[model samples]
Target: MKYVMVFFFLVLSILSCRKNKKDLINNKIIYNELIREAKQFYRLNDYSKAADKYEKAFKLIGGINNTKDGYNAARSFVLAGDNEKSFNCLFELTKSELNYDSYDYIISDTIFKPLHRSTLWNNLISKIKDNKEKNEKNYDKLLVALFDTIFNEDQKYRKSIDSIKNKFGMYSPQLKKHWETIHRRDSINWKKVKMILDEYGWLGKDKIGKQGNNTLFLVLQHADIDSQIKYLPMMKNAVRKGNAKPTHLALLEDRVSIKLKNKQIYGSQLMSKPDGSYYVLPIINPENVDRRRAEIGLNNMADYLSNWNMTWSVSQHLKMIDSIERKKNDIDFK
Candidate 1:
């Protein structure tokens, strides 16, 4: 009878060890699978699937504490139309040692096209501290390289400019050809031109005007606060002039007031144009701080902004004039 009891104890110990081992192996598999699957979905632009896989992985890995996984998860969430989850994931990422590149990706990536001017987004701006030294160094290096390639071949640059002009008109008929000439005069002066646009409230218009329907928001994705401030006024003016729709303009106004400055005003005057193309102006504001918040707001605006004119703003017109001065050499478009 004593031997029988000892045998039973031994069996229980073995079973317990086996269970632990299986759990460990399974947890490892979940991590590996999630990472692999997330990459696959991302490559295909299947953000929804990628987000789900990432979420599952996060759970199995024990949560947002995993910085690399968290970063990818948040990015996937942005693509998946799950702004809340993306925001949470980004917030978690901020708590870790993620670098300026992470924050830069949030700011510059076109995926967050809709949320550039939100107050909630602005509130989160504190998360990305300035990396001026690094940014300047990087920018200088890239700019130098751009100039060396574009300086010797004026004709090559002219063709690129024409392509930009032709494409710009497809999305924004309002863009003037001369503006691109002015924007690219120095061959390597895009940075200065961008800064000038920002200072003058004409930022993001060039790129936005140049893209097609699918990439209209790409410019807005990089817009800053100053640019949004400049754009909202224009949108308001369009509304008051009866050039745009009240409903759509009102929605943008509401988002700006609530998510940007939280200032509210009621007016019967609205824009006469459709919101589809016009919405891109505000979305491109460089000061746009949070991808998730901006995306949520943009998606919501889509229903109302459908018919808006795909035209460029006055500032955008100016940028076209600026783009003509570029000197092309050998910089790969990629």
Candidate 2:
């Protein structure tokens, strides 16, 4: 009788644990769904609804885990004319580690321009600056600033290309000159990055600020394929040593694979159609792509693709690919 009672209790405990885990997953799904709706609202210019949805999702998650969503939430509230909520949201960010990591972006974002004149904004900036000063106390601040300068220059031309396109049009002489300028800068930046990597190795977020550390990847990403191939092994080792982010490594992997005309493992690469639609590039084992992405700390494919105004479903994608292949074969035969 005693043995049977112990066995029954153990079975119940195992079942209870399973139930709790399932419930946790379901809640996470719900939170992500809310965020998706919030982003959809923002895209549609319905700032009030976007703010409401973001607030709901944040409440469900207990607080902001990363600065991106919180920044979005604060911006939404500002656009919706809810100054109090916007202030509260930005205040919440100062309480997180993103305080130092996000200081530059938050300060520069034009969406927060309205809050700039207020006392609250001044206080927020003071707190964030303190966080940054504390974080950099033991590091070489000049080296950190140097990496930041490199990163800004690396991004300068790329960020301006869209505006230049609007002004001069694609394939125009002006655009050609712009590309030439960008390429020249890329060459200079690549040489600098190679020198740094050779001397100091991979400087991840811990050593440099987020943008500073990201300069390494950005420079190499803009370089020739040979440079990317050269650094792939080193980046892998950095990830193993906890000196780099696995998510960034996944993107570099996708870039190299796509350039080599091989299937990408994480489905991070996307190809655009002439009509302006986009589709994910070839992925290995489409059914398990999301599983692999999760292992590397990437979000769900559907959510990630939402940024590009694309919808994703592995089943739908596979079927579309099959249909296209069949049509191609029929035309070739004819």
Candidate 3:
């Protein structure tokens, strides 16, 4: 009777371990698959579906406290025009370890444009402010002022560019003059940014906070390719440490790569042909591009290309490039 009882207990323990291992594997698979699907939907601009999938991913991975998926779900909900769901996701985020710095993202991102006029938005901001310490609030105020200054300058630059485009048409001969003016203004802004970075050292998430970092990123996005390359390593490290979004870093990398005539790892930027057709800028490993993009939380290349009115097929693109290369060879041989 003693042996029988011991044997039964051993069997139960073995079965429990097996079950636990299986459950862990299943959970990991589901979490990864959900994130991939959500990114696909996001690339297709199906914000509602993206939000749903992200929420599911969050639940599977232990919710807002475990991952930043809830914040992404919130942004997607806003983009989908579901302010209520967006607010709910934000509320969930508030329960997590999110700090006053997250409030900066909530206020600065254009994704939350739909929620700006809502009472819920106001309440959330007020709640965040009230929860912060006095020193944090003062720092936040300073950050907000800097953000406002940069944002206003950006708005003016954009307005001027649009006015020029409207008056001269998109490809006008006189557009060069406007470009010169824009470049001059950009140079001045770049100088200001350099001074800030000299004092702040990249305006990292821990220093000036996320909003400040985002504002600096915006400035860098408009700067010359050399400037982007100089900061690329720091930005990459920040993304790896979860201090910055991978998508932003990917986009910047792609942009700089395109300018340098190098193959981009993430196909975030597109180029228009002379005939008005668009194609993704050169990609490094064209075959496994989507897989690489997925690893970094970006969407599938096909759907992302579709946004620029381009159809993506690896085989087809390869064939086209081959033909173009052959033609060039023929001309050179002659």
Candidate 4:
């Protein structure tokens, strides 16, 4: 019995070593195949298939550095609507001992946009943003990288936390209010709110005020309670002065696509705080779930003002745009 046990152990060890060797050889062959196929798949627009092969290749060979094969594999994942996977590939590649330009494709490509929604993507982005925050890079370099992700993911809070990190410290109340509206199924105009805040940190007095029935407030009003309270001593410096609205506007349009694609709309709205301070919030768009319903009345509400019935079809789809425009006009009225 003792002899049999010893023989069994010896055979098992031998098998294990052989298996490891076979795996290593198999990996080499698969890695070469991946390189060949990834390029072909990408050129043929078979992104999904290419992505699958890339993932398998990565599993077998681990990460390869400074090679078009790995880079193109990441690109295929992005084109395939799997940004998380693309990000993983790039992340692994970036960590390789070999140095390569991962940013090469990002500069000329739009494929990386979808990954802006991923948490992993945001974490990596912060590393990049950190460099900029320290003044090691220019605004164009930093902002473009930041904006690309947020814009592609439609800047939905559910998609990524970066947007929250970007503005929450400054606009807590507004951010909370926007979140509440989403919960209550009230009009949601966060996309527009983001634009206003991004361009002008806090809305100056000219952009907001108290009126008879409706009070006007800028992005500052939505600031987080802590920041609002914290900045009280430096109240005068809270607002940002710039014409960054145009850039925000461009991004806002893309965010609104999530709403417009479903043909949703909203009306003028206002929010109030315990301090008697009132704010007019931007419009809310429809949820992605509602947008995808094949039936019109499956979840339709009679009270809801759809795009076909609105003053402008585009307005129906963009509550954030409408709300900001309303606030803009209100500023003119004052």
Q: Which is the leading candidate under lDDT?
A: 2
Candidate 2 per-residue lDDT, tens place, 1-334, comes to 9999999999999999999999889878988888888888987789999999999988887877778788889999999999889998888888855564456656766778899888899898988878877777766687787776787777767766766766787666898899999999999999988998999899877788677777888888888889999999999999899888888899999999989977789998888675546788878889998899999899989899887667888888788668867987999999
Q: For each candidate, give its TM-score against the true structure.
A: 0.34, 0.82, 0.61, 0.30
Q: lDDT of candidate 2 vs native?
A: 0.84
Error in Å for residue 199 of model 4: 46
Which segments of model 1 are wrong by more than 4 Å? 1-18, 96-101, 130-334
Winning candidate number (TM-score): 2
Clashing pairs in 4: 171-223, 171-224, 172-223, 172-224, 173-223, 173-224, 174-222, 188-284
Write model 4 residue lDDT over 46-155, tens digit each, in one string: 89988888777776765554455666777898898877767766665544253332232243354576776668765755543443344322234433443334333232
Which residue ranges in model 2 land beyond 4 Å of their true spot? 1-22, 96-100, 155-185, 319-334
**Candidate 3: residue 205 Cα off by (Å):** 2.0
lDDT of each: 0.48, 0.84, 0.72, 0.47
lDDT per residue for candidate 1 within 257-333, as digits (tens), equals 53473332221112323432222322333223133234433322222222231333435533532452232222333
Which runs in model 4 stand beyond 4 Å of their true positions? Answer: 1-22, 62-67, 96-105, 116-122, 125-334
